[model samples]
Target: MSTAAAELRSQRFAAAVPDLERIEAMPLLAEIDALKRARNAVVLAHNYQAPAIYHGVADFTGDSLALAQQAARSEADVIVVAGVQFMAETAKLLNPTRMVLISSLAAGCSLAESISAADVRALRRRHPGVPVVSYVNTSAAVKAESDICCTSANALRIVESLGVPKVIFLPDRYLGHHVQQ
Candidate 1:
């Protein structure tokens, strides 16, 4: 094996290799890449992924929020998120016009569990025309209704982007306070 492959194999994971190998598609990774290029889709993987899946992606890598923005700006007509559910949702939220698919639908976020569109609607009703700035950890339904989205890394910038002196931050309260700070 090459040195990089060896290093990846040595890394620890919660699932056993045999468990993943029963219907392994690693063999088709090259073919999948070729197919994606033919179809003009960009594949995104996250920073926390298993090395095999991470390295096999087509175009880019980052934290969930960054990958979402990448999907939004991509020239490709389709986006395949080789990551988790929340990541896929974020991508779809940003790329509402583009086709977005997930490698696995079971992946999710408990923090993302914190808010809903009804909540945003109610909040917007109370605030009344105040801009809603949703954290990127939210569901696409929530994001679709938001005026703008922000990552922890860029929350302040996003808030400032609205050119408004005040905004309502959502889903991740700590991120709200962090950005306010």
Candidate 2:
């Protein structure tokens, strides 16, 4: 690697995980970069992903909505999501024609696990006629059940945009509380 690239890698590791050895990451990063180019893929990483993946290999990195928007806008034939399962599913939902893959199939999140489509269906049963605004942190099934999708940044706007007195916001208690407030 060039001196500048090495320095940048070291800085990224330092910023994300201070104890991570820079030398331990070079080979992996090289392989990942080569794979991305070979597959004509763009890596979209979430802000919470490892710094090496986020800053080193990812073509785009940001919060959930930003990553989803980027995935939707990407022209790449393949998309690699370097976050949790829900993120990968979101990318696939947006880019139906693109090949979307997650870095790890086992990766999951608390927010994603907290709710299900059955739960959402029950909510619909209870609230008859109320629109459901699902947070993007949810699973594809949950999102499919939603009337619309919203990110934490736009939850309130989405709820209000429905032009209804109430909307069922799911999966994320913190974001739901914030939106309610």
Best by lDDT: 2
Give the range where candidate 2 is weakest over 10 consecutive residues by summed lDDT.
Answer: 13-22
User: How close to the true structure is residue 120 of candidate 1, measured as C-alpha lDDT?
Assistant: 90
Task: Kindly provide the TM-score of model 1 when superposed on the true structure, using C-alpha atoms.
Answer: 0.69
Q: Tens-digit lDDT track for model 1 on 20-81?
A: 74236455755676777688877788887766566544367788867877887887888988
| Candidate 1 segments whose C-alpha is farther than 4 A from its true place | 1-26, 93-97, 126-130, 160-166
Which structure among the candidates has the greatest TM-score? 2
**CA lDDT of 102 in candidate 1?**
90
Over 42-123, each residue of candidate 2 has an lDDT whose tens digit, in order, gives 8888888866677677777888788888998998999999899998998898889889999898999988899999999999
Residue runs of model 2 more than 4 Å from their true location after superposition: 1-20
TM-score of each: 0.69, 0.85
